[model samples]
Target: MPKGKRTRIVALTRTRKKGLDSKKKLMDDLRSCLEDYERVFVFSVRDMRNAKLKDMRTKWRTSRFFFGKNKVMAIALGRTAEEEQADGLHKLSKALRGQCGLMFTNSAKDDVVDFFGKYVEADYARAGAVATDDVALEEGPLPDFPHSVEPYLRLKLGLKTTLNRGVVTLLKPHIVCRKGERMTPEQTRLLKLMNHPMAEFRVNLVAVWSKDGVVERLNPDADGEEDEEEEGSGAEDDAEDMDSD
Candidate 1:
């Protein structure tokens, strides 16, 4: 066969892919924000909730928030003095080690601080979340719950319940959860069914970087916060998707 007319087959080989284009774009955007915004803040989220985050995004449409992808964000801010995008950015990057994010804004510092400090949303606790308070059901008629749910409360949830006069009644005092204890899936579900919200989703400012090369540590005690990656919890997977905007 003539070389010009020969058919070619490509061989597939395993090669480690490096430097994701998405990550590069993020780095570029972060660097751009460093120049464009008047201030950058590192904030940590406790009990992350996507709906609340989306609400905040809408409320602060002019500002930018980046969540998840901690390593990429840290690199974008510059991990060291020699490679930092700007003065004091390296210190800000250090705060990115935990379940935290970066906020870039031109808003006044006091306004931003006041808003986040007061912003707290209570949500139903998910499995693996620690209970904030003790939840118990009295040994009596549960008039709030319908009789149809008696079987589910008894068999599925393992709750001691009975249908008495078309009402769900707890045969004995039941403890749903205890304070400072990690809740199980059943416990969380029962709490939700009872219309109890134990998880408090709040964002706390850890550090801040200003355009004037000034870095302020608002939460120095948060240095030891654990990174979510280490736990492999995948708790913020939904939050990561929301970052697409």
Candidate 2:
């Protein structure tokens, strides 16, 4: 080792150790969320853009939404879910098969369900998103784009572009994407450029748990109708998926 500038051992964080710590913290926080609310709603999230999620979180002042690794959520609610946390909450934890999150609200379950039913906002589709329908654009002057972007749009993005009156214009009409097609990076970019957002963002409330431990699933077979549950004790939810990551 040099006396003037000696090298010291740099501590490296082990992946397993760091991951375990993070998982533990997430479990603790989620358990706390479960304990705070009279009811917990399990819901699915898709195309969850962080900015929009943040805005929605801000708007819903009375409700708290916690999204995390599904495994962590399941573990936190309980290993068996029934014995560790309040009643029926384990059902929600058990159903954590995909991307999922829990919503803790003091509001009435019916009101929450109705709010979710009517709440839908359009957002840009990202790569890996499935196309719901064909998106076609007609040839026109796209004055929204500046003339400076014409070269990049034409050369890089495979779009026919020309400058007219200090604005960019599309030279031809073409189908941007087709139904059932998996969105590509280029397609996502082009949609954004065309200001055509393709994804519908909304919360699908799958299950709800009461403070007294009643659990009910929002039965989709009945046209998103609520299913009746035997009233009991325990505050638990086991439904839907919310993958925060």
Candidate 3:
């Protein structure tokens, strides 16, 4: 009898995890920075924005920024004097307990300090953010908005609106948001439509580590020391996307 063609069965293999490899690479890179850079800085961000951070990174092209899990970063710097790769690094690592990152630079300390101290970017506020100022719309013709948006403004934003002669008009004064009050999603949407920006993104230097075995505490009130094994306290590279405007 003639033999029929045989079917081939291929075994599926699971992909190997790269988490450990990534962490090892990060540790190696950090150690290399310790050898290359003159100083290492621990900094925290307020209202972190990736765009602004990338811009800042461009401005400081000579420096290196490392954002990773706090525990992993701490391990890279060493959590104890005996294990530390450099003098005073363990102390500096102690300040990396929260949402923060490291900056390794050869720039003058004063220059780096001045640049970060003066760097502030204004951005739009997001929902759940506190209103920076009162925003109210007076009862009148909203010629800025198209008549097509009147229904959205009335139904979605809960605003009193009407269409008058092909123009969107407010039937009654509407308080979009109050100062010091948490903003609602609708309020944030209205603010964006109105082109209002209220959030400010800034970086705060927490501590500095010098090659001469000196550790300077800049922001003592920052996050306190946390156990290296503490859960749910990883240092995130970026802020929550929901908070982004």
lDDT per residue as tens, model 1, 68-142 = 477778888889999898888888877776677788999999899999999998899999998888889999999
User: lDDT scores for all predictions?
Assistant: 0.81, 0.69, 0.81
lDDT of 3 by residue, 167-225 (tens): 98998999999999999999999998888888998888999999999999988775534
Per candidate, the number of residue pairs that clash is 0, 19, 0
Q: List runs of model 1 lying over 4 Å from the truth.
A: 1-19, 227-240, 243-245
Best by TM-score: 1
Count backbone clashes in candidate 2.
Answer: 19
Q: Where's the lowest-lDDT run of ten residues in candidate 3?
A: 235-244
Spell out the clash pairs found in candidate 1: none
Q: Compared to the true structure, candidate 2 yields what TM-score?
A: 0.75
Task: Provide the RMSD of all predictions against the true structure, rounded to 1 decimal.
Answer: 6.7, 7.8, 6.6
lDDT of 2: 0.69
Model 1: lDDT to the true structure: 0.81
